[model samples]
Target: MESQELEFHTAEEDAGLRLDVWLTEKLSDVTRSFVQKLIEDKHVLVDGSAVKSGFKLKKGMTVRVRIPEPVSAELKPQDIPLDVVYEDADIIVINKQKDMVVHPAAGNWDGTLVNALLNHCGDSLSDINGVIRPGIVHRIDKDTSGLLVVAKNNAAHLRLSDMLKRHEIVRTYEAIVDGVIREESGRIDAPIGRHPTNRLKMAVTFRNAKEAITHYTVVRRYPSHTWVRLKLETGRTHQIRVHMAYIGHPVTGDPLYGKKCSLMDTGGQVLHARFLEFMHPTTGQFMHFEAPLPDYFTRLVDLLESRSSGG
Candidate 1:
């Protein structure tokens, strides 16, 4: 497959930013993890020389990235059923299940939400995100089940992208954290970036970080766990998980940022994208959809509540 090349020149305002972070923001469709992969494979260059993902940018430096075509050209449609919340000519809101990768990446090249959308929506999905991520507007973690909207066309894709950037979209999530948060409600305003050493995980760090805010209200308190509802002010990679872990209450069963001695295991994290609110990209009408807590999540909550009450 032929690769595509894109170039960027660092401006005064871009100086001091990490290469992977800057390139990810510029690409818009790809993730920082993918960008870092490109850097590792020598597909990224600064002033025509390969550089590390964390290379600090200097004003006037020219950065070039080579985007390789997806592994498979003819992506097949899988006959997987989607728990669709809402569907229209322009968008599809899905209550994605846990263990389902949102898009194909690296080890996950099939059996993704995109493949399923290909089967359900067929040729109606948007191609603005290229071949791999057609119709995908945003993504939650594979282990994090939730509601996400997919665009069916280019016009819808553009408008929805704009709405996301402007924070016009509202995404509310419910998570079981490993602590009893005494406060009824609180806000976490911190910058999230790649962990200094882990590289695979995100952390609340000022270095090469982006602004992330999460507002959470304690729904219920257990002896060892707390149920909380959280809303995102900005969507950064693993923002909610990182912020929660930073505040000493990682989401229960989260393999990456969770506590080792978890109260219970629910296959993955006990987080669900429960509510989504946004304006219809094409219709100019208000739109809102909800996905109730998945059975697994509710079952865990029930067990936790029962245990807290000595049941």
Candidate 2:
């Protein structure tokens, strides 16, 4: 693989912005931390001179960035168990367990759903997402248990990706959040992007943000907690968690976006992808799948119910 170089001229509106921030806005796929790393490695230059990531840009200043090719590594197969709900020649739907990563990334090199799929499906899985993420069409957070569909071939992958982009695939999630939601149903329409100061977190912002919408309905309400059913109109990263937190009802046990709660000792956010509906890529038939909540989630809900009933 060959390295790619990108050049950009700072516009009047972009002047006085930090170099890394400018680049992050210009390169939507890359992160600010990665841009800073490129600056530290001297791969980013201002007018052919190496500059710090925080250097303020001037109007008409030329910025050049050199992006090295990603190193390709052979993914090893793992014998991790999978709760496969449906399988066919074109795709497979799995009820992913909590705490299980969907694919291998920086710190996680093995024991992911991709690795498990490699062993389970052999070479039948799609390679559209590269070897590191074979057959993976979409992802849920590592701690968020849910249902996901994996493509078995390139054609299937392309169709699924297109359907997801058009918002034709139906995905519904169930979560328990802090505080009682007074509204019977509501929609959160906000743009989401990387947090300006905290790069590790996503926030609702208009700057270089993508449109995200989440529709939620109250399923049940306890004294202090509320269970909600959510449907995504746009699948932005951390959309559900960020939106729920933005509305002041963060998901219970969500360490990143919500306060700590002892009622659910599940070690992660109380969120689950309960239902999925989509058209099969090969057969063109409508398909639907549902996953039952894990014992931990059910138990916590029961506890909340008991408390609400004064038991």
| Index of the highest-TM-score prediction | 2
Which window of 10 residues has the lowest lDDT sum in candidate 2? 24-33
Candidate 1 on 1-311: residue-level lDDT in tens?
46677677788977898998777655533556778999999999999999999999999998877777767646789999899889999999999998788988653577889999999998999999999999999999887898999999999999999999999999999999998899999999999998785544789999999999999999999998999999999999988889999999999877567743345558667889999999999989998888888888888888997898899
- Model 2, which residues run further than 4 Å from truth? 1-73
- Candidate 1 residue 90 Cα shift, in angstroms, is 0.5
lDDT of 2 by residue, 81-124 (tens): 99999998889999999877788754356777889999999999
Clashing pairs in 2: none
Per-candidate total of colliding backbone pairs: 0, 0
Error of 2 at 113 (Å): 0.7
**Candidate 1 clashes between residue pairs 3 or more apart in a chain or in different chains:** none
